[model samples]
Target: MVEQDSTFLLIIIALCLIFDYHAVLLPSAYNQTAISQENETRAESIEGTLIPSEVERFNMSSMDQDYIEDEMNYPPIRECSILEEFKECGTACEETCDDLRQLIICSQECVPGCFCKAGYTRETKGGCCIPTALCPLIKRSTVCGPNEEYRQCGTACPRTCNGIPEDCTQKCVDGCFCKEGFVLDLDKCIPESSCRVTEVCRENEVYRKCGSPCQEICGVQKETACTGCIEGCFCKLGYVTEEKAGICVKPEDCIPPKYVKCPGNETFTYCGSCEGSCQNQMVSCPTECGSPRCECLARNNYVRDKFGACIHISDCISK
Candidate 1:
C-alpha cells in the first residue's frame, strides 16, 4: 500500500509540470502577435504624414479662385454696328457735289459710317478716302468784263501796273491791263522804244538796239538779226551778250553753250552747223536736235578731226 501511494504522488507532480510549461509558451506566442500589429499601425501613420492634402495640390491663391469664378459669370461682348452689312437708303445720291455735300448726306444715313480717318479726306467725284490736304481748288465765275476774268488778287494777278496806273491797289480788280514786258499803248500793249543810241564804246559798255517798230531816223533802214529787232544796241561782231552786266564781251567771257557727245565717238558742238570732217569734206550735223547725238553704221568707225565723225573702216587713219 505504501508503494502505491508513492507512485501516485510522482505521477501527479509530472502532469503539473507539463501543464505549467504549455501555459508559458502560449503567453509568449500571443505577445509576438500583438507586437507585430502595433508596428504595422505605426508604419501606416508615417506614410500618411509624407503625402500632401487636397487643398495643397492645386497651388492656387484665394484671389485667383475668385477671379476665375467672376470670369465665368461675365457678359459677352457686343458687336459694333459698323461691321454689319449696309442697308441702302433711298436718299443716297448717285453723284454728290463735293466733299461737304457727301459728308452731309452720309452723316444723315449713319452717324459715323463712311467717315474718313485723320490725315484723309473724301474725294468729291467717287467719295473715296484720299490723303489729307490734297483737295482740288474750287473756281467760280467772275464779275469782270468780257475780256477779263477774276483772279486771286496779288496771288495770281500782278501787284504793280508798271507806273501806268500809279494808283493801282494791291487788291484784286477787273480792268484793262498790258501783258508782261510791255507798256500800255492807247488800248493795246506795245514794246518800249525809247532806248538810248550810242556808237562809241565806253568802260564796260554794251550796246542794245531799240525794240521793234521804232520810228525810222535819217532813212537808215533798221535790220532784224537772229535775236528779234536789231534796233536794240548789241555787242559787236565776235562778242556774245552778257545779261548781268548788260554789255558785250569776247566769246571767252560768256558761258559756253552746252555740248553733248554724239554716236561714233563724235562731239556735238553746235546745231545745224558741221564742225568736223571725215575725208576733207564737211560732216553734216546729226538730224536729232538737243544733244545731236549720232551713231556709226555697223561697218563704220569714228575718225577724229576738228570734231568726230563716223567713216568707213577703209577710211580710218592708219596709226
Candidate 2:
C-alpha cells in the first residue's frame, strides 16, 4: 500500500508541472501565439504597400499669357481704308520712323482700290489694281494721249479708262476706231475711200456700171417673161419676144383676156382669150391675133404666120 501511494504521488507531481508549464509557469505557449499573431499582422501590412500623401500639385502657365505683349506697336499712318482690310490706317506720326512702323501710307490721301481677284482688275478713283490678264495696262501709261477716250487697259478687268482726256494709242486702249474714210480706225491710221462713185442698190437689184446703156440695163430682164430677144432685137418696155426652137420668134404673145368663157361652146371670140381646151371655139383672144382656133393652134405649134394663122413647119420652111 505505501509503495502504490508513493508512486501515485510522484505521477501527480509530474502531471502538475506539465500543466503549469503549458498554462503560466513557462512562456513557450504564449510566445508561440504572439509570434503567430505577429506573422499574420506582417503579411497583412505587406499586402497594402503603397503610401498616400497630402502634398500639392505643380501648375503651368497658358500659351497666350507667355508670348503676347501687353501693348500695341507701330506708328499711325493716314491712308485710305480698304473695305476688305482688317485694320484702319491713320496719319503718319513721323516720316522716317513712322515709315518703318507696321503702318502703310499712300502718296496721296486716297481710298484703296477695289479688291481684285487673282486674274481680275479693280479700278478706283485713286488708282487701279489690275491682274496681268484682266488689264494689260501695267507697263502702259494711264493716259494714252490727247483726244483719246479709251484708257490704256492693263491686265485688270472691269477697269475704266480716261475718255476724251487722253488720245487712244495702240498701248492705251483695248481698241481704237475711227469714222469711215478718216485716217484712224481701231488705233490704226488708214487711207480714205478710193471708190469714185458709191452707188446705192435697192432690194433685188445690184449696182451695174457698163460702157453701154443696153449692157447696163440688160441684167433686169426676167428669164420667164423674156427668155431671149431676137439676135438683133431688144426687149420692149411692156412686151418682149422669145426665140422658138431655132429661128422662129414670138412676135405675138398670149395674154390674160378681160373676159372668160363661162362653160359655153361659143365665146365672144374678141377682147378675151381661154387657156384651157377652147371648147368655146368662138371665144375671142385678148391679144386679137386673129381667130380663136387659129391663135391657139399657132401658139402651141409655133409655126404660125404673122396673121395668127397656123402653117405646117415644112411649108413655112419651104416658103
Off by over 4 Å in 2: 1-62, 66-175, 179-189, 195-200, 203-319
Instruction: Give the alpha carbon lDDT tens digit for every residue of 1-319 in model 2.
Output: 4355456445544543443233212122111111122213222121232111212111223442232211112232222122212123332221221122124454654333223234433322233323334222222222333333333332222212111212233332243333334333234434444223435433322232221133212112332333322222233333323222222122334222445442322222222234322222234446333333223343343334344344544455454
- Superposed by TM-score, candidate 1 places the C-alpha of residue 183 at a distance from the truth, in angstroms, of 32
What root-mean-square deviation over C-alphas does model 1 reach? 41.9
How does residue 233 of candidate 1 score in lDDT? 44
TM-score of each: 0.19, 0.17
Question: What overall lDDT goes with each candidate model?
Answer: 0.36, 0.30
How much is 209 displaced in model 2, in angstroms?
Answer: 17
Give the top-scoring candidate (TM-score): 1
- What TM-score does model 1 achieve against the real structure? 0.19
Candidate 2 lDDT for residue 265 = 24
Best by lDDT: 1
